[model samples]
Target: MNTTEIFLIAILVIFSAPYLVWRLGRTDYWAPLVVVQILCGILLGPGVLGAFAPAVYDHVFAPPVIAALNGIAWWAVMLFVWVAGIELDLHQAWANRRETGITAGLALGIPLTFGALAAAFLLRWPGWSGPNARDWQAVLGIGMACAVTALPILILLMEKLAILREPLGQRILRYASADDIAIWGVLALILLDWDRIGRQLGFLIAFGVAAVLVRMMMRRLGKADRWYVGIIWLALCGFGADWSGLHYMVGAFLSGAILDAEWFELEAMDAFRSVILLVAMPVFFLSTGLKTSWEGGGPAVFAAAALLLLASVGGKLAGVHLAGRILKWPRRETHVIGWLLQTKALIMIIFANILLDKGIITSATFTALLLMAVASTMLTTPIVAPMLRRLGGA
Candidate 1:
């Protein structure tokens, strides 16, 4: 089959699947839309359908499509992070720093410690013949996964449930916003080589200094024009970071955070979010879904996935609950916080891909971690919604 045939077939399947789902009275299903496209790609790739129809999957979902998808994915990620930064109510966060601190401490510290210990113990056990740093990898992976809170999803859930104004909701919002800053910063430091630590810190300090300067400039430019200045600042930040060997997304995030502190207007963010939601983000999610794999492994692979998922979810609940207890939070609030912090997405996949790309982890481990990522996201979404609702109602 030629490229045209492959593309034509892929396009047919993509369009057809949604119509089929919609016809089945499932027009509201985002998961099936993403999942089906991914499964189709797998089937068409060298994996399954490609085994028989080589020209179709390979020539079709080829480098061009893959690259295009990746570009879309990054754009979506930027917009998502942009929304995350904008949604952060800095004034409220400042007022609630103590709660934010306690929540973040419980949410991050316990899971990281437990995960690291588990990794160390498991690496020395039988049948795991990977690297000598198997323990460290496992520990770091768990810590990173656990420390992640789905800021985008959490905010959407909070809004959907009309709990955004509640005290519990407010704290979760504030802490999650603040927590991501700390967690990602820590993950970047831990995951990157030690030699780069000075460079990374220097970049951060420089970014901070630049942000202060930008804020002053924006203030002088008048409040109404700050959003435009903010956008330019964000772009510069991302470009600078990308050029400096750090992730552009982190730069975008910090840029957004700085702007959020300065502008702090939900309406301004709403203006930006319209384009991000309708256009940019779906591409990112679709590409992320496409990169995911769930094939060729047997029971052990699936078992490892299950184990990681359990650890990810269970550890978060326990850790966040502990945070609540330590902070003298009510039981209801504690459970809600536990549920809120359990979802993982982009960073997990990105990190796993990095490790796989760097030859740090085996393909099997990468597959299992991908499975872990999907499972973690699925489990947290529904669970967090109800938990938030319960806390709000209480």
Candidate 2:
């Protein structure tokens, strides 16, 4: 529990966690790594192991340590956002895919309606002393939280399961990409000052122009050196966005999506992915886990937690189902896609952290939302995968 020991543990975790994941992938127990990673954190954190070993927990999760952890979390999110952008296939979805439009509408509409209703009730309820429950900001934040679709989790699952190339998978990715852009746009409008929108739009236009220039510049660079340059550029974009009052992940995502569209072949993309995923993302995930305090207050908290979970699950189902019907898709495909899209993870955490940082939601609410995310992810993935298999689809 001393300073020396703390440093060692930090080193061990940083160096070993990803190695463990890689090794586990070669064994029969590979699927459990995600659960194990979080569970290990819970045990070694304030929940159980820390309860029994307070000094160790204090030494490890100290204020300085927590601050460092938050840095890692932000970095991890940026990596994930970068990967998200790289995965974008702009023209993949049929331009007239009724399924795309309908499914997306359902995804957004169901959550917005359900979230607003849920927030209205939560605001009126007792407990929740952390913030002014009735604040319009709280309602906006919660509504947006409920409306989130974890596009990264979807992409990861689709890729890991080797279904990324499937038609349904392509549809999900295409629809999800469009949906992600729109959702962020909606989030910006909800959160930004109305006067800033024009400036924000201007910055985006300029960023697009800059990206083209950067791509052309990169084309003249040596193949092995573009990655180093890309890192510098990524950091600059992140800095620019932060300075402009935009979130860091937005800059990272934009940089990524822009790169994806720049006619880079698989080799350049692969190199880019290696740096972002191998080095950056694990740090981000560990940081996110460390910042999050899963255990919260009393019975009222638990009730609120349950409601959040239900809203996340139920809202997605309602939205996807209605979208499918509108598009005249098969009932089973519609049902599968509904469940497939509900498992919120990476992007939800990124956006939720933004709300938490802005004081729009309390730490307790963020914790509850995290729990809702983990629960939905664990359940939805297994459930949807089997359904996809049954339908002889992805």
Candidate 3:
């Protein structure tokens, strides 16, 4: 078959297999459609599918086909990340800085510390850190992965729980929003290239100046024009960042971060997000899965994943519990918040993806982080639902 035909087949498989499992299996209670989609990607990847059926894998994921799909995945994730950046309720976070700071600080910091220690242990073994990575970069990359709270995924979960607009839910959004900024900042730091330091600094200055002009134009533009201009801005920023060795995703996030969510209609923004997820993000997920490797052995990867999970979950709960004490929050509130805050899902996967792209972590480490994220996200609803009910009861 031609590359287009093969790519179409791949796309069909990407959307179909996940939907069937998510719908027919009725796994939504334990695993949301998003989580299932991610797992399906892993199963469809070279590690599982290629191992079992190399011939079929090669046919479907031919070199040309893979290239085409990768292009789609890159843009899809860029738009997705940009939307997440735009949706960040920074105004709300700043308004309630004290509580947001305490909760967000502990929520991110403790997991990062635990994850770093876990990474330190993993460093004793080979095949975890990527070839281009420094020891410090590997440790910091893994640690930040554990600390990530996928703001987009967290928002989806809150919507699922019917509390997205509730006071508690909004509170959670504030905390996650603050952490989102930090996560990207850490990514920029991790991706910093000393050889390209001048370019990076130039990118920052150019970005600041361009951002001001864009903001000025946005304020004067019609709502419809804003969307078009915003996309153009996304592309330009992505270009600038990539040229500077900071990665285009960094630019994507920054482009959206500067925009006010209110610039567009709420319903339109929701529809846009939904459309992007339905149409494009499956490609990104599949691309991620295709990169998964068991070169270090499956058992080792799973073990590392388990360790990261323990660190991520344990640290998040500990930090939140500490914050609860200081803030005088109820015990039930702490429990619910902790589990919910620990939700990893897409953001951590995205974080790990960046690490892999920068050669800071190997595929084995990426697989481990991916598994840890899925497991962490799966635990959130199951654990938080009951605790939330108890809070409601009280």
Write candidate 3's Cα lDDT for 300-346 as tens digits.
Answer: 99999999999999999999999999999989888888988999988
lDDT (Cα) of model 1:
0.61
Off by over 4 Å in 3: none
Sort by lDDT, top down from the best: 3, 2, 1
Q: Give the clash total for candidate 1.
A: 0
lDDT of 1 by residue, 1-394 (tens): 6655654565556446544654574522223233333333334445345556777656656877667666766766666676576666767767877777777766776666655554455455443223533456556764565456767666655565566677667878777777777765764554454556666667778898998898778767766677677767777877766555566776777787776444546666656665665455445444444544434344766776676676677777888787777788889777766876775554455555545444445555665666666566655546655666676587
Between candidates 1 and 3, the one scoring higher on lDDT is 3
State each candidate's clash count: 0, 1, 0
lDDT of 2 by residue, 299-322 (tens): 555677688778878898888877
Q: Can you tell me which runs of candidate 1 are displaced by over 4 Å? A: 1-54, 117-138, 194-202, 222-227, 261-264, 293-298, 346-366, 381-394
Checking candidate 2 for backbone clashes, the offending pairs are 76-284
lDDT of the candidates, in the order given: 0.61, 0.67, 0.94
Candidate achieving the largest lDDT: 3
Residue pairs clashing in model 1 are none
Worst 10 residues of 3 by lDDT: 382-391
* Candidate 3 clashing pairs, residues 3+ apart or interchain: none
Model 3 root mean square deviation, Cα atoms: 0.7
Of 1 and 3, which scores higher on TM-score? 3
